[model samples]
Structure formats: structure tokens, C-alpha cells
Target: MPWSPALKSTLRSGLHLERTVTEPFQVLRGMLGVAIVLFGALALGETGLATSAALGAFIAGTASYQRSFRPRPVLALYAAAGLSASSFVGYLASPWPPLYVVVLGLWAFTAGLAWALGQTAGVVASTTVSVMLIVVTLPENVPEALEHAGVIALGGVVQATLAAIWPGRRWGARRDALADAYASLAHYARRLRHDPFASFDPDPLMNARRAAELTPAQARRRPSELAGMRSYAERIRPVLAAMADPRVGAAEEGPQRDRARELMGAAAEILDAIARSIRSGRPAPIAERTYRALTVPGSGPVLDGAGRQAALRLIGLLAEASDAVEAVDRGDPVHGEANAPGHLSRPGLRQLLPVLPHALRRHWNWSSPVLRHAVRVGVVAAVGEILGRSLPFQHGYWAPMTAVMVMRPDFSQTYARGVARLAGTVLGVVVATGIIRLTHPSAWICAGLAVVSIGGAYLLMRTGYAAMSTCITGYVVFLLAMGGEANTSTVEDRVLLTLLGGLLALIAYAVFPTWQTVRLPDRLAAYVEAGGRYSAAAVDAYAEPTEHSRALLRAALLEHRQTRAELLTASEQAAGEPVRHRGLHTAQLADARSAMAALGRTTMLMEAHLPPPQSSPVPGAAEFAEVLREQTAAAARAIRADEPVDLHALRDHYEQWAQWLPTPAADPADEPGGAADLVYRDAGLLVEALEGLDSALNS
Candidate 1:
């Protein structure tokens, strides 16, 4: 009944189509690539070439579906080259079952390792594996392997050309991302008005920020800008919660309470205006008004000491938010100094060579999900290939390919993909058979249908994985028919072998599964450790402002981001695991996610308030900074040991800081010495959030 269940429900509801089909451009891009490849093959009077070419084009198109700062042509070239290499290997070993099985296993291992790199690389690698599985069945002499590979490469070129033609709506995507972030802030604002302790749903905004991160670093809507927006939103949450405390606001009809409510109302309106401006490519209409309201004379009405502190903090945060929104008005980066870090760095050849050993040492392990996946997929595929050869399977590749496709790293998705593949295969075989029987189309018509089927498959890919599978299954059947293998026997064998492969995948996973939830503790601990370092860097920067401190802060932030990504992935994989196999229940996972989000927001706030070079720094800043850093490290240790964090000293520190500004002070908000006091108050909010997390963990 608590917020955790509601949070879990919100996440799971995305299994429906709304979250799946984010944009129509992806489908369009994929369809154009397949159409060009198939039409070209037809024009050349070689229906047989359609199979390899279409496969190559489709895979390449899929790889470049999400536009990035990396040139479309470059990404397309890599995808094409990989596909061509896979085709050559598959064709060369087609006749020798023993050799083919060995090559397939090696390919699986290398391709599986790609997953450790990132999502885009993983997609390209998996599609290459798929290309190999399909092309191996093409009846061609060993010498023609290179020629087939070349044709596949040509298909990749065609896709690249299409990608260049329609480079996507870049600004529109940015607007949508920024809009989502502002809208999330608006949602939190409304909630704070009623329940300060309301659960914060960070997924929508974080996902939007990630989507923006996929764009080029030099893009107008940069990752740093999105990050700044997220920080502003996060900074306000705890402050508003603090303000909402009954002790902070006077009884009914009090001046301070009225002022607080007015400030919240104006802030919510400004957030909404910012969201609209993002969507409409216009300036935030209320930015000036909001700034005035927040900084106006007597903004902090007479209130208790804690109430004044909360009010002052809120005013400072609102002022920062106004500046950010104004920058958005001019389409400028939120933080000019902070470069938006890429999801993965592109190192030079020499740099990469030296780092390979470290990379291998980090990722190559029995406990790693990617390594286990490589082993599982390779072993199962080899066994499947052997059995397919021994049995009277018409298309031996289909069996092993099915197993490869269905066997994911997580148990739930592995089982789900198996079921989806089976259902799709059966439906496709029926549909293809009926069409062949009723129309009896010529080779040209069959080729056209194959192209159409491929197009439709990609169009529906994001809508539902099963729907995409259904279309792909039909396309393959029709494609083989075009290549002169349209016999009823071939059709029957395809259906039977596909079923066997799916069953094999299920059995293999049942025997030895890779459960992400099992490693959640280690992943969470690593995240906490990274977060602690980031916090330490930030506090250290405050105490001793220097270029070196700033660099350390950036490096620590990058580390934390990477760790956070891993934790998010683990949480998702855990969600997909079966209940019996899950390491933590739904509520626990939600709690962990909430804690991590709070920490991330707090870190961003620290970055926002990082002090510039100070001639004479406040003496107390050093002591306070050390205390903050120590608390952060203590938090990491507590999480790793699954113990409640000791926060009694932190509470006392907050009380001492609150004593700096009392009620009825002369010019409390405008005092020149208020900078340190405001920072102390903000730190108190962060400490409170940490205490909330400690309580959640204990509960």
C-alpha cells in the first residue's frame, strides 16, 4: 500500500505499447533500407541475392535506428562490414558441419562480448550473429562466399545512403526530451503541494535525458543541459518537503505559509511554461516573472528558524532554475563549462591497445552476465547445430539460430522470447503457406512480398517483439521460396525445427540460468562506492576550489554515471526474472531505485552549487566538507553491509547549521554572508534524503 508498489506498477505498465513505440521515424528508416536492397536485387535479375542483401541491409538499418553524434554513414559502415564478415564465414563453412559448428561457437563468443561494451554495439553484434545463421543455409560454392559477402556489404551501403537522406528531426527530439524533464518537475511540484513525502518517479526524466545523450555532443540540446535540468528538479524536491513540514509553516492564515504556497504555485507555472517552450521551440514566457517572484523583496516572510532556512534554499534553487530555463530560451547549453560526456569514449588505436588488457580483465569472468551469456549461447548453439545435422532438418541453421535468438541473459526474457518465437513461427508458416497456395506468385512477386514482409517486420519491431518476429518469420519463408526452395516439405521442416530450437533454448536456460537479481547486491555496492567518490570530489572542490578539483569532480561524475547505468540495467533484468528466482521482491527493488535516484539528484545539486575560485574561502567550509565526505563514505559501507546508516551526528550538524539564520533577522535573505549558510541548508536537505534512504533500507 506504500509508494513502492505504486512505483513498481508504473514501471511494469510500460510492457504495453505506449512505451515501446517511442517514435515512428525508427520504423521508417528501417523500411527504406530493406526496400532499397530488395528492389536493387530484383533489378539485377538475381532473386537469390535478395536473401543476403536484405539481411545485411535490415541489420545495418536496425543498428543505426537511433541517431547519434557519430555519423550515420560511419555506423552504417561498421554494421555492413560486420555483416559481410559474418556472411563469409557462414557460407565458407556451410558444407562442413563440424567446422561450421566450431566457427559458429567462436562467433557467438565474440559477439556476446560486444554486449559488455554498450547497447548499440550489442545490437550490431547480435544482428551479425543472425546474419551468419541465415546465410549459412544459402546454397553456394565455397568460392562464392566472398561474392555473397560483397553483396551483403552493398546492402549496407544502400542503408547508409537512406540514413543520410533523412537524418531525422534533431531539434524535435531535443524538444521532446527537455519537455519530458520539465513536465516531470511540474508533476513533482503538484505532488509537493499535497504530500511532501510523495514518491519521486525519476524514470521518465532520466530516460529522456539518456535519449538526449545518444545525440552528438555538439548538438544544441546537450547531455549536460539535460543533467542540469534534472539537478534543478531534484534540488527542489527535498527543499519543498522541508518547507511542507508543519514545523516550518505557521498555523492557519500565517504570512510565511501564504508566501510559501505562492512561491510553489509560481514555480509550478514557470516549470509548465518551460515545458511548453521546449515543445514549441519558443522562450519560457514566465521566466522573468518567476525570477522576480523568487527574488522579490521580503520573499522570505517571518517564520521559524528552520522555516526561513527552507524558504531561502527554495529561493536560491528557483533563481538557478530561472537562469537554466532562460538559457533554453536561446537554445544554449545549460552549463557551458561542463561538456556532455559521451556514453562510450572513442579511443585512438594506441589508446585502445593499451587498455585492452584492463578491459578484458574487468569483463572476462565467470560471474559476468556477458561472459555467461557467451558460454551459454555458444554451447547451446553448437549442440543444436550437431543435432540438426544428425536429424533430417531441411534448414539446419534455423534450429541453432532459433536457440541463439531466444536464449537471453535473463531467465524471464529467455523464456518469453522462446514463447514469442514459437508463436510467431507457427503463425508465419501458416500465413506463408496460405499465400503460396492461393496466389502461386512468380519469383518476382515472391521477391516483392519478401521485401514487403521485411519492411513490415521492422515497422512493428518496437511495437512488440512478437509482432516483429511474426513478420520476420514470414519474410524468411517467402525469401527461401524465391531462391527455389518452396516445397511443402521445406515448409514443414522449417516449422518443426524452429519449435525444437525454441524448446532447446528453454531447457538450456532451465538447466543453467544467468540471474541478474543474484548479483544486485554487488551492483548496488559498486554504485554506492562510485557515488561516494563523486560526493567526495564535489565537497573537496568546495573546500579548495581549483582546476584539479574541477577535473576530479568531472571524472568522478563520469564514473558515477557508468555505475548508475549498470545498476539500472541490473534492476531491469531483475524485474524480468521469475518471482521464484528473484533475489529481491518488488518493494525492495523500488526502494533501492528510490535511494539511488536521491543520491544522483543530491550529487547533481552539489555540482550546480560548486563554488568558483574564492580569494578568502570560509573557514568552516573545510570542516563541513570533510563531514559531508565522511558521511558519503559511511553510506557506501552501510549499503554494502546491509546495515542502517548512523546519522545522529549528521542530524546534529544540520541543527548547528540551522542556528546560523534565525527568525526576524535583519535582511535574512539578502545578507552577504548568507552564501555559506545557504550551502549548509542545502547540505542538510541532502543529509535528510540520505536518512530517508537509510530508513527505507531498514524497513
Candidate 2:
């Protein structure tokens, strides 16, 4: 169809609006960075000040805004480190000579400390770069490089201060994030209600990601990083319990709709808590409490007699699961909280040692290997940079950037990184070379490009390590040209260096021979254990399970959901692991997801007919676990292809397990019939191990 005059006008209007939106932040940040560069030589961190200023201008948009001003202390600590290190370290090593190299151990020590302290990435980069730039490595042009570092550090400080002062600018974005995340949750819950069969869909992360992605605007709007809330899914059942069960929701409002409403409400509240904490810059105590509550059977009373029996029985099941989650959280080496409290008491090396008992620690997945890989990256980066400087290639030293990109978890990442490095370098070098070759742009132009590189730096961040390098290259190229290095030969050198950097990155990645396979199973098991502990808390509460147990469970569940996210990251990383481990990884992942669902389902059943806390043993609560454990044993045997589980053995264990909770009244007319018509559902998935080999297995 032919375009109409109206359409043309609309298109133009849209373009203008888009351009207007993009210009200010981008332009201002660039200008600020350039100004900082000019100032830092005199003032200590000119670039940092500029970068921080430019970043701070959009202060309203940080994750903290959602919390109503509460910031995550963890991230805050990092910013503090970043800001202080500039001043503290700058003073310590002044008049830093150009082309100097830091000792290997010092760089490793700094980088390792950051990783040890829980900064997995950006901080690690900062620390290594700090060592290379500030400690040992310096520029061919000392004055200019020092000027740049000072400006960068200055930009960072200004940005940090600005963000702390005003969070409202980013409040809307934070709010959007909460809204979108919940909206996705609601959609999924609704789907589950409509088609429980959808559980057969093996790839939940994909589904969740898809659901979130479909509403791009909403996903983008979430204020909390939430970091792949797989554990949070455990809480959904409790939220569902509050919604679906009459006692939890409006009693007279009717069960069908009220359950969903209450569940959605609880979820919203939790999300709100997250948002509120982020925006306010305060931690969400309620979020932590409510999340913990998710592990236990909800406090709703058991329904009419028969339903009540089922609910009571389920209570026992869920409580056992709660115990498992608790096991993971408290003193279990797997989750590492055991070492947290004792950190100050022990030697650092001892503290780093695995604290979980052997049995508990056996459930290892590669994801637990955070510290090791971080050290690897730091060591490699420092070593490669030192090597690069010594190389005969007087023109280009590309290894440091390569080391940064390749250092993460694996090698599958290397090729793309290589490509990105090469591409970004060439692009940046060309941009730098041309400007210097052509007529000079104003100081404004120079400053503006510098600032634009910051945004480009953030945008291209995950895209490639070379992106940051590119921006720096562009700035350097512009500086070179400004100094009249505009000759054809200079342009040739620029291209050559850029190419060499790309090549060097590839070499570093390859030489390291990293692989993608992440230790997913180990991570998955940790989540399972956490989930199990949460589940057991409900059961163990006996008659008077306190809110404390409930709170603990919720946190455990929350922790579990967080792992669900890492599981996905591991899946990507797993591409390089040996084939044998991959299957185990998959099984473990499946087990975790399944265990979470089963655990939640029990909580839901309990919510349907909650018994008073520990109102007597209520019959077969004792045997319930025997049944579940038996089932698990059976399943294990099945995996081994051992002799079949003995029918007699299975039946006996089932009977005992089946005996949990009070039995329903014989006559409907005599009492409220609790689930008499419903078929019995086991609270936990049962695995049947071969009875014949039981003795042999023990041996």
C-alpha cells in the first residue's frame, strides 16, 4: 500500500520522539566523562567523576528505587569499594610509572578477594583492571593514561553519589519490573490451573523465560533482578494455598475464585516486598518472613472431617520436606551458611574448605565452583597482560581484554568473544583513526564521543568484552589524532593494534581451553535440599509449628527459586562438560524441579485442610516418611536397573506411609467428610528400589 501523508508525518514524529529520548542522557554522560578526564589530572579521579556524573544523572532508574529507597547492601558494598579504592589506592601508589607490571600474586590476591566476597563478575573486572592499570601496567603515554583513569574513577564516584541521593527517577522502571514479573507468574499459575497436564513440558526455565519475554515491556520493567526465581516457584503453592483455601482467603467469598485471588495477592505482596526493599534501599524483612512461610503447610484449618484427614496427612509430608530445606541452609556445607558465622574464627583457607559432611557434600554440581574459576580468570589476565607487554609486537597488546572475556566459566564463550573483540576493536579503531585523520571536531565532539562510549560500554557489556575495549580504543584513537597522529601510517598502526587485540583475545580463550558445562546438578541438589528443609519444617512443627519455622521455610523456598535461574546458566555452561555428567546434570535438574512441585503440592493439600499445630500425633504421621523414603529407594534401584522392588515390601512401606494423619469418619452424616471420595495422592514422589539387593547395597 502507498504511504499516506498522515503516515509519513506519524513516522517522522515517532523518530523525533525517539531521538529526543535518547539524546540527553547519552550526550550529557559523554560530556561529563570528557570534563572529568580534563579535571582528574588536577582533582584525583576525573574520568570516574565524569562517568559517575553521567550515570548519576539517571539516578532515578536504579533497582533501589523500587524498594522505596532500600538498597541491596551487597551491591552497595561493591560501589563503596569501587569508589574508595580509587582514592585509597591512588594515594598509596602515586606517580605510577608507565609500562610497569604488577607482581602476579598481588593481582591474583585482589581479584580472588573480590570473588571470595561474592562479586562474581563486574567487581572482578574492576579489581583486575585496577591492578593492571594502577598497580603495574601503564600506558605508552603516561600523562594521558593517568588522566583517563582519574576521569573514569571520578565519573564513578559522582554517579554513585547521585544515585544514592535520588532514586525516584528509576522508580517507574522498578515498579514496572515488579508488575511484569507478577503478571508472568499469574499467567503461569492460571495455565497450571487450567491444564495441570502442562507439567509434562520438561523445560520450565524456557517456559518461564518465554512467558516473561512475551511481554517485553513488562519484563524490562521489573525492578528486581530476582535472578531466575526458580526457588520462588516453591512459594507459589503457599500463595496458592492462601488463595484457594477458604480459611486463608475470604471465607464467604467462595473458594474457586478466591483461591486464585489470594494466591495472586500473596505473590504480589512478595514481589512488592522485593520492589519496596529495592526502591527504599532497605532489605525486605517481610519478604524474607513470608517467603519462609511458604515451606510449611499453611495455617488454614482442616476442612470437614474427611478433607481434614487428608490435609493432616499432607501436613506430615510437607513438614518432612521442610526439614530437608532446613538441612541445606543450616550448617550444611552445600549451602555454605555453616562457614559464614565461623569465618572470623578460622584461617581463611580453613574457612574456604567444604564444611558439609561427606554424605551431604556428595551432591556436588559444578556451579559451586565460583571461587576457583574467578581465581583462574584473575591469574590468566595478569599473566597474559605481562606476556603481551613482553611480546615483540611493539604495536598491539590484546591479551588483557581477551583474558577478561575468556575468564568467566567456559570456552564455548570464546569464539563469540573473539569475534566481538575483533569486530568492536576494528570499529572503534576505525572511528578513532578517521577523526584524527580528518579535520578536528570541537572539544565538545571529543567529550561527546567519550561519553557515548560509556552507554555503548553498558549496552555492549554482555555482548562482548571488546565493546568496552572498543570505546576505550575510540577515545584513544581520538586522543592520538588530537595529538596529530593523523598520518596514513598512524591509521595503519591503529588497525594493526585493533586486529592484534582481537587475535590476542582469541588466543587467550583458546589457550585456556575453557568449556561451557556448568556444574548444574550440584547446584540443583543444593536447591532441592533447601526446598526439602523448608518442606520438613512444616511437618516437624508437630502440633504448634510456629511462624518461625514457616518463615525459615519461605526463605528456603526463595533460595530454591534463585537456583532455578543458575540452573539455566549452567545448562549453557554444560555444553562443554563430559557427556556422562550432562545426563546426571539433567537428572538432578529434573529431580529438583519435580521435588519442588511435589513439595508445593503437599503444602497445597495441607492448606486445603490444615490441622491445628500438633493437635496430637493424629495417627500415622509416624509412618508417612517411611513410605516416602521407601519410594525413593525404589526409584534409585530403578535407575540402577536392579531387580524389581518387592511387591510385598512396597505394599508394606506404602501402608505405613499411607497411615499418616487421622482417618476420615466412617459416616458422612456423622461428621464433615474430609476427602472420602478423593483418591489418595502421595505427598512425595516414591522411588521403588529392589528389595532383593537392599542387603547387598548396604554392604
TM-scores for all candidates: the values are: 0.79, 0.59
The whole-model lDDT of each prediction reads 0.67, 0.40
User: Whose TM-score is greatest here?
Assistant: 1
Task: Write one digit per residue (lDDT tens) for candidate 2, span 1-699.
Answer: 122442343233222211112234433443443345433432443333333333222111221111221232223334434433433343334344232234332444345334333333334334334333322223334454454444344444544444445333443343344334434544544554444322322234333333322122323333333223333433343434433333323243445344334333444455444434433434444445444433334655324333333333334433333333334334333222322211112223243355423412432333334344544555565565566566554333344544454343444344444555555667787776676457576444554655565555534433335555576557544433332333434555546644554455445444543343434444444544444444344443332345554555455544555655566566655543333342443444454455455554454444333334434332343344344334434444443342332325544654555555345455432432123211133232221212322222222
* Residue range 281-382, candidate 1, lDDT tens digits: 555567466666666565345554555666677777767776766665565644433244323234433554776567657878888877888788888888
